[model samples]
Every structure is written in structure tokens, then in C-alpha cells.
Target: MISDPDGTVLALFAAFCRIGGCIMVLPGFSSARISLQIRILLAVAVSMAMLPVLWDQIYPQVTGKGHSYLLLVTFETVIGVVFGLITRYYVLGLQFAGTVLTMMIGFNAPPTADVLEDTAENQLTNMISFAGLLILFLMDFHHVVFSALVDSYTSMPIGAKFDPQNVLITLTNTLSQTFFIMLRLASPYILYGLLFNIAVGFVNKLAPAIPIYFISTPYLIAGGMFLVYFGIAAMLKLFADGFGPILRGL
Candidate 1:
């Protein structure tokens, strides 16, 4: 009855190494704000739980020689990281859109705190990041990570050998989609800002006498604030819609 405990344990450790590495970089689990210990513990728990169910399926496929477990382990890690990064890239789209929207509306205030580690980002950008993270949790996408992990095992088999070309293609495709989604989300703000700036420019051109520069800045800010307050609800809905597709695509 499989009495080779040492071999079995080694195989299990190898599998855990792959899973744990993936989780550390995974979207929901890999938050920059979260503690490292928590992340490691969570990965360990998940790997332990899934190992028995997955070992038979994954072990046979991964053929290799001694000490070169590094290659197999590396391949598994890359697969996991790629899967997680795809989802994260989309969420970053949400943040990028929010930053653009805020800049257009004149709310480009300096950031108050350290966001996503030591990076001091703009306030509006931070809000969108936080809000998007919150929404992801609210919608329970974290559970889907497990589903994605399972699918990865099937999509990229353990011993199938890593394909850098395909991985790069996938990442490039995801990044492109992220840029498109960000522009789409912030399109309304772009239009509003554009029109407002044009009108103000015309006024300044027409009446060179009235100190237009000083007065118009505040007016633009106020108008932008008003528009954003009303439109934020709609913007969030759009984010949710776009995020859903991106997650599914991943």
C-alpha cells in the first residue's frame, strides 16, 4: 500500500512548493497590504488540502530526473503566477481608469498614505484600487481562484514543458485588454473635461481683460466634482461589468 513515505512526502512537498508560490502572487491573496505570514499560511493550507486530490493527476504527467525538480517546480510556479497576474492586470485597469477620471475632473490631490506597499500614489487612484478590491471580495471572486488553479492544472499540465511564447502572448493580450478597459471606463470624464476646457479657452480668448485663468480653475474643479458625484455610481457598475468578463477570460 505505497509504503515509501519518503518519496510520497517529497512529491507532496514539490507540489506544495508550486501551489504556494502561485498563491503568493495570486490576485486576491497577493495583496501588497497583507502580511507575508498570512499569505504563506494560507498557501500552505490550500496546497495541503488540494495535494491528495491532485497528486495522482499531476504527478504522473511531470517526468523528470533528480535535483532538476527545480525545473518542474519553476514551471509550476510560472503557470501559477501567470494565472494570478491576468486577474490582477484587469483590476489595475480599474485603478488606472479612476486616476484618469479624477485628473480630468480636477481632483488630482496628492496621495495621503502608502498604497500597495511603499508607493505613494494619487488619492483618486488609491480609492479606485481599494474599491475594486472591495468589490472583488464582495462578489466572491476569491473562491474562483481555486477553480482557476484547478483549470490551470488541466490547461497547462505538470510535465508538458513550459512554453514561453504562449505565456508571453497571454500576458501581452491581457495587458492590451487592461488598457482598453481603462480608457472605456474613463471615457465619459474625458469628454466632459475636454468640453469644459474648450469652453474656458474660448472665454479667455474672447475676453483677455478679465483674469480668466484664476477664476476658471475653481469653476472647472467645481463642475468636475459635481459631474463625478453623479457619475460615480454608474462608473462602479461599469467596473463590475468589465471586471466580470476579465475574470472569466482569465
Candidate 2:
């Protein structure tokens, strides 16, 4: 019943180069906790599902293309990785923000195994990162990424010349925007840390004989924790809100 099975296979692989590339570095899906087999199956399934809709676009470009087909695969995979990096960078920004918050609040608990990855991370950082990621999933952020991928075919079609300059510019802009957003989220804590340390310094000066550093640490951590309890909702909301504009800018 199937016609041109060879061409169909070529087209499917071409599509996989892009979609699978994205999934390879995608946030939740790319976690170290996920087995490689699962990621491969996921990429293949998504490639197949998207193939029908993209048949007219992908099939013609790949079928019977000789050596040029290899070029197409390379460019396609690069484009996919670029798209995945955009989202990945944004999520990593949240992790950076979490680390900043932890230090600011004086929450120097020993680093523990990260909930989502094999790396060790502060408990506070892990909580903030996981919570931000969970909120994004709840809000269906993957759907947005997939939509962007579908739209990318229109913008950067198969066999199109790869533009490293544009890719660099896009990534640079993403980092700039992510840094600004994360800074805003962590600013209050930064301020808290600065002021808290200053006050403690003054107290230590006043009571030189007292173990002021030892006495003040618990209060510093408690105050920071209180701020986190009150401000975490807003922080996550801001983080989630920034994801859309960043992706759309791409």
C-alpha cells in the first residue's frame, strides 16, 4: 500500500534530525534521569507524527538528493539544536537565579544530589529550579516549543543555507534577556543579603567580644527563608512569563 518507501524513510530521517536534535537538549526530556532509549523513541515518535503534516515540505527536499542530502541533515540538526538551546538556556538561567538566591539568603546547606540531574546542587537551588520547571510543564511550555519547531520549517526550510551569524545573535540575545530577567527575580534577595550583612557587621563592631558572626547566621537564614516563602510565587510567575517572549523572539 505504501508508495516510495525509500523516499518516505529518507524524509522521516530528515525530519528526525531536527525534532530529535531539539529533544536531545530539551529541558525535562533531556534530563540525565531519562534513559537514552526513551529519548530516541520519543524523538522517532514525534518525527513520525509530524511527518504527515510536513510531508510536502520535507519529502521533496530529501528524496533522491545524493550527497547534498548529507548537508541538509547537518543543517537541519544544527537548526534543531539551536532551537533546543534557546529553551535550555532560559531554564538554566532559572538555575543560576536559584544559586544566587541561595547565597543571598545565607542558606549554605551542604549540596545534595539534584532532583533532576546527576549533579550536586544546594537544596534551595534544587527546589527553586524544580519548582520553576514544574510550573512550566503545568503551563504546557513544551507545546509552545513544538509549535515553534513547526513554524521553523517555514522560516528555515530544509536545504537552506545555515546562518551561523544569525544563530550567534539569537543566542546572545537570549542570554542577555535571560540575565536581565533573572537579575530582576534575584534583586530583592541580593539587596537583602547586602543589608543583612551590613547590619550584622555593625552589630559585631558594637559587641566585639560576642560571637556575633555565629549568633547572626541563624537569623540571616531565617529572614531569607521568610522572604523566599513570601516571594517564591512571584519569582516563578516571572520566570514562566519570560519563556514565551524569549522563544517568540527566536
- Candidate topping TM-score: 2
Q: Please list the Cα RMSD from the true structure of every candidate, rounded to 1 decimal place.
A: 2.1, 1.0
Tens digits of per-residue lDDT for model 1, 1-250: 8675665666666667667766776665776788899998887788878877787766554444477767877887777777778777888778778778878877768777746645787776787777777777787876776777777777777767789999898889888878987788799889988998898889999998988877888887888778878877787777777766666655
Superposed by TM-score, candidate 1 places the C-alpha of residue 201 at a distance from the truth, in angstroms, of 0.4
lDDT (C-alpha, whole model) for all candidates: 0.76, 0.92
Look at candidate 1 and give me any clashing residue pairs: none
Query: What are the per-residue Cα lDDT tens digits for candidate 2 across 78-175?
Result: 98999899999999999999999999989989999998899999999999999998998998888888888989999998877889999999999999
* Candidate 2 runs further than 4 Å off: none
Q: What would the C-alpha RMSD of candidate 1 be, to one decimal place? A: 2.1
